[model samples]
Target: MRPSRGLLLFLLANLLLIGLLLHSVFTLLTLLFEDCSNDAIPAIDIPAPDALEEINKLPQYIPKIIHQTWANESIPEKWQKAQKSCRDLHEDYEYMLWTNEKARNFIAKEYDWFLETYDNYPYPIMRADAIRYFILNHYGGIYIDLDDGCERRLDPLLSYHAWLRKTTPSGISNDAMGSVPNHPFFKSVLDSLQKYNRNWQIPYVTVMYNTGPLFLSVIWKEYLPTVKSEETRVRILMPAEYNDHPWSFFGVYKGSSWHRNDAKTIFWMGQHWLLVTVVVFAFCASLYVCGFYAYRRVHLRDSNYSAHASPFSSWSWPWSKNGYKPIKHEV
Candidate 1:
C-alpha cells in the first residue's frame, strides 16, 4: 500500500536517526576493543634474583656498540673499529643483533649512505620492526640503542621487571625495553609491531628509532596528557637512569663527533612525514563527507531525483514540491 506523505517523512527521519546511532555504536566498539585479542600470551621466566644481582655487580661499564648491515658490507668492519673506541672507555659489549626484518630494511632505506660509505659496521642490516620478533622467536634477549649507551648495569631494570609494570604515574616507556623468553607483554609488543609493519614501511621504522628516546621527553615536559589507563605490563624506568630527550648530558660538549646534523635532519623529516600523511588523510575524508552532503542538497531536492535514478538517489526528498528541500531527517 502507498504510504501517506507524513508517515513517509517520519519513516525517513527514523531511518536517519537509526543510522547515526548505529555508526556511533560501532565507532565506540572499535575504540574500546579493536586491537584486543584473547590469544594466549606466552609465559616468560624472570631472571633469577641472585644471578641478576651478581651480573649487576660484575661491571657497570659497557662499551657502546652499533650494529648495521649495508649494501657495502664494509660497515660491519667500521662498526668493529667504533666498538673498539667504546671498549677503550669500558668493557666491550658485543654489537646488538637486529632481529627485526624491518630494522634491516630501515637501515637500507634510511641510512643507505651509512651502509654504502661506512665500512666495518658491527650489526647486519635488519628491519627494526622485525628486531623484537627475531629476538623473541630465535633467542630471548634485549636490544639497546648505541646512542643511549649506559655505563651503569641494567640488572636493576631486569630484576625489577618480574612482569611488565607501569612506567610512570600512568604510562610505560618503550625505550630500554626487554622481554623474557616468552612473556605476554613481549609477545604483545611484537604483535603490535607486526601489525604496524604490515601497514606502514618507512614511517614505522622512524618510530622504532626513538620509541624510547621521545618517552624521555614526556618525563620532563608531559607532552601527551594521559594514555588510557586500562592496559598492563607497560613499564618505565626512573628518569635519572633512563635519560630522555631535551635532557642535556652534562660535560658533553657541542660538536662531540657523536652529534651529526644530518642525523637530526633525517629524524625531523620522519616526524614531518607522519604528520603530513595524517593531515592529508583527514582532509580527504572531510572533503568526501562535505561533497556528499552538497550532492544530497542539490539532486535530492529536485524532481529529477528519483528512487530509481541511481544508488545515490537516497538523498531524493519526494514530499517537497520544489524537490530541493533540506533533509531534516537527522541521523
Candidate 2:
C-alpha cells in the first residue's frame, strides 16, 4: 500500500528538524573548541641576572628613550608627572617623545601600509596603542604608557633585546615595553597586526584583541618557538617586577577611564569549555530523541488505524473532557 500524504509530510518534517538539530550541534561544538581562551599561550620564563646588577650592564647601541603620546603641548598633569619621573631617573638619556602628528607622519613615511590601517581604525586609542609597536620596531627603545610612572630606573630592562611586562588577571601587558631596533619579535608583531585586527563588538574586547595586551600576548606566544638561544629571546617582566611599590620598576596610575566591563564581559565557554560541550551535546541529543519519538507516535498511530474506523473511533484525545469514546462508523 502507498504511504499517505500525511505520513510523507510528517517524515519530511522530522527529517528537516533532525537536520537542523545536527547542524546546530556541530556549530556549537566548533565554537566551543575554537574559543580563544582555550588557546591562551603559556608564559615563558627568561633567565635573568640580578635586577640591580643588570642595570649597570646596559647595551650601548640601544636608544635611551622613545615614548609616545597623542597629546601635543597640553599634556595631562598626571602623565606629565609620569614623564618627569622617568627624566628624573635618567637625565642623560635622549628622550624623543612623539606627539600624535609626528607619530602619524613617521608611520606614513616608513610603514605606509600600517599607516593606512592606523588612520582607518574604528577607535582612536587603538591607533595610539598600535603605533608604539612600529616605533619600537624601528627605533628600539623603551615605550611606556603615559600613566606608568617610573618607580625606579629602567636601565636594567634595556639590557634585553626585547621585553614585555606581565599584567594582572592574566597574560602580558603592552603598557610598558622595551626592544632593540628590528627585533624579530616586534617585526612579527607589526606584520601580524593586520591579520589579528578583529572587531569583537565590545569596545574593551575589540581594543584588547586588536592593539592592547591580548594582541601582544598572542604574538609573543607565536614568536617563542623562533628563539634559538637565550640571548635573542624576548624577556617578560613578571607582575612582581613591573608593578607599584619600591621593589617594582614602574607605578601604574589609574589612567584608563574609557573601557568598562559589565556582566557581558564574561565568556561562558572560555573556562571549562570541554565540560560545557559535553553538557550541551547531551541536552541537544535528548531534545532530538524526544522530538523524533513524538513525531513517530503521532504518524504511526494515524497510519495503523483501520480504514473504516472514524478518526476518534480507536484513539482518544488525552486532554479531552469526554475521553476514550468509540464512535460508530457507517458501513
Candidate 3:
C-alpha cells in the first residue's frame, strides 16, 4: 500500500514534467511546423536552357530590380565574380546596393520607428539581415546575397507575388528571396523584426534568431496559418529549383562570412542532430527514472516509519519524567 502511494506521486510529478516539455516544444519548435520544401507550395518552374523564349513569356509580377547589401561599394575580390555573374545576366534589371551608411539612413528615413532598434542591433549582420527584408518589402524585387550568383534568367520567379527558398528540414530562407513591393508576407516579416530583435548572447544565435534566416523562417511559419488564397500565399523554391541543379535559379558560393566560433558548434549539432536529439531524450528519460525511484524510495521509507512506533519513543528511562521507575525487586 505504501509503494502504491509512491507510484501515485511519481505519476503526478511526471504529469507536470510532461506539460512543461510540451509547452517548450510548442514554443521553440515553431520553425518545424512548415516544410515549404518539395510540393508544399506553388512550384517556380523554369524552362530549360534551350527554351529561353518560353521563359520570357512568363508574367513578371516583381519589378526589374536586384538588391544586394554590404558595408560599402567595394565588393570583395572572392565574391566579385558572383556579384558580376548576376549583373552580367540581368543587365536589364536595375540593381541597388544598400551599404551600411545607405541602409542606416534608409531605415532612419523610411522606417523611423525602427531607427532606434535598428541602430541598437548587437551585430552588423543583424542590420544586414533586417535591411534586406525592409528593402524587399518597400522597393519590391529580388533580394540576393552577394555570394549567390545567377545561373540563368530570374524571369520565372517574378511570376509569384512573393517567394522564398526552402531550407533543410523546415521553413524558408531570406537569401535570394523575391517579392513584389508590399507583399503581406514581407509585411509580417518587417513587423515582426522589432519584436524578434533580442540579444541571444552568442553571436551566431543572435544574428540568426534576431534578423537572419531563422528569424525570417519563423515569421513565415507563423504567418502561413492565416492564408486564405493563392494570391497571398508565399511561394517556395525547392532545392532543385533553387541551386542544386545546373539550371537552378542561383548558385551558392562561399558565404556565412559573419560566422563566429560558436557557428562551428551549431553546424556540428546540425550535422549530427539525430544523435544529439536521441542523446538528449535519453538523458532526460534516465534522469526521470532516477528521480522517480529516488522519490519513491524516500517516500516509502517515511511511510514505513509512520506505520509503527519508534523503538526509542517506547523506551522508559528512570531519570526522565517520561521514564518508568525501577521496581523494588528489580536489583
Best by lDDT: 3
Q: Which stretches of candidate 1 lie over 4 Å from their true place?
A: 1-126, 136-138, 162-175, 191-194, 199-234, 244-289, 304-331
Question: What RMSD does model 3 have?
Answer: 8.7
Q: Residue 78 lDDT in model 3?
A: 83
Question: Compared to the true structure, candidate 3 yields what TM-score?
Answer: 0.82
Per residue, candidate 2 scores C-alpha lDDT tens digits across 1-331 of 3545654776698688778877744533443332233222222221233455544654544578757565575778767788788878878776777788888999999999887788878887888888899888888889988788887777666657777776644467788888889988888999989997878887877887788876777777666668887556877776666764456778877587446663233444445556766897698778767875576466545545555443434444468767555433455
The most accurate candidate by TM-score is: 3
Candidate 3 residue-wise lDDT, 59-85, digit = tens: 888999999999999999888999999
Models sorted by lDDT, best on top: 3, 2, 1
Q: RMSD of each candidate?
A: 12.4, 8.5, 8.7
Order candidates by TM-score, high to low.
3, 2, 1
User: How high a TM-score does candidate 1 get?
Assistant: 0.41
TM-score quality measure for candidate 2: 0.66
TM-score per candidate, chains pooled: 0.41, 0.66, 0.82
Give the residue spans of candidate 3 off by over 4 A.
1-14, 27-44, 297-331
Summed backbone clashes in each candidate are: 37, 0, 0
